[model samples]
Target: MFASGASRRCFLLIVFLLCAIMSRSGVQGGANLCSVDFEVFGNVQGVCFRMYTEDQAKKLGVSGWVKNTRQGTVVGQVQGPTDKVREMKVWLSKVGSPSSRIDRAVFSNERDIPKLEMRGFGTRY
Candidate 1:
């Protein structure tokens, strides 16, 4: 309902300011950067869990590293847009691989990071 020229100008200014603020907060429109450390337990090893994780992460546009722990667990970090990271979490908790059973998924140290640390998803070793 901006009828006058001055009113339209004011509306545009407000829109611009809002965009600038959102960009500065690691949020570009609806996207935001996030990071989380995760540990997966249960029959995760010997089933190509890391490979499946890398595949899923790349599909979802999340970047990080996954590696098999000495304690028979899988540990890794995931960093990406908030929505993509959440999707990755869901995948980790439910669908690990066709042959593996996920008993527990421990997520911790989750927070909004400044930026992504990895370029693409890959297995560390």
Candidate 2:
């Protein structure tokens, strides 16, 4: 009886752990729960800012894309470890476009784009 009880407890624990892992990855849970969105404003256009951002994101292993808006802003989506996303924001502000000025940056947990493929953070049409 003692051995059977121990085995049951172990099985329950394993099941709980699996659920937790799956939830964190947004696989079992709803999508956009683990991703981050960023809106970068400034002299982000016309200075190769998009290319620079793409390079940085790829180096940091961030999965997302950067693009320019008609209103002259740079918008990007980065999905990865939360820490890495935060670090990318810092890098963008400090090492972004030399000719461009990063006037504002906004971070949100809401997932707007769905399953967007990002290849090295380049510009999108």
Candidate 3:
């Protein structure tokens, strides 16, 4: 029993040290970091879509930039935890601002990233 207790304590200590190291290195606790670029089509422009996207991304702890495309679409790249990025994608596809109509959400250029490229969500001109 004493040996088991000692082994468990050692394991916990190792995990704690690894967590501290990852934190100092600016990495989430075993969470994958990734980026995805998406474009929303149909009635997305001039409807506060970008603002809403920024808000959602910030709420989800996603770091990236969003912009309005001249082609009447909203385009953006989001980088963060895989789960949070997926959540953001769902939000963009289904619940985009109260005023905007999201017809189609197409995602592309998604890949694992070493780190976040942006600090917070922002609307790009």
Candidate 4:
């Protein structure tokens, strides 16, 4: 009976150790994921541009947040598969907010983006 109890305790300890290892590994794996940031310029403000960008991004399965900057530029940081990000850029450039005109767009790789819970999109003061 004592031997059985010892064996059970040892098994539980091993399981606990494995769980810890997996959790740690998962965090490291997530850190390795890549993301990108985009700075969109031109009539990107005051015409529901941010909202439109968010919608397009969501439709493309791109994960990120979009907000208006003080300079009237729409800034967005999208993180996901490279292809999806590119698709979002194309969609935004071609068929974004009808009232807004896009002047320039810059893309760059970023470290990681914090998860955001946005309804549609929003303007930042």
Could you give candidate 3's per-residue lDDT for residues 2-103 as a string of tens digits?
379889899899999988888666575556889999999989888899989998998998999999988999999999988899999999999999999999
TM-score of each: 0.80, 0.63, 0.79, 0.59
For model 4, the run of ten residues with the poorest summed lDDT = 114-123
Instruction: Count backbone clashes in candidate 2.
Output: 0
Candidate 4 backbone overlaps, count: 0
Cα displacement (Å) at residue 27, model 2: 17
RMSD of 4: 7.1
Best by TM-score: 1
Candidate 3 vs. true structure, TM-score: 0.79
lDDT of 2 at 11: 87
Q: What order do candidates take by lDDT, descending?
A: 1, 3, 2, 4
TM-score-wise, the better of 2 and 3 is 3
Error of 1 at 51 (Å): 0.5
Kindly list the per-residue Cα lDDT of model 4 for residues 6-40, writing each as its tens digit: 89899899989987887666443332334667788
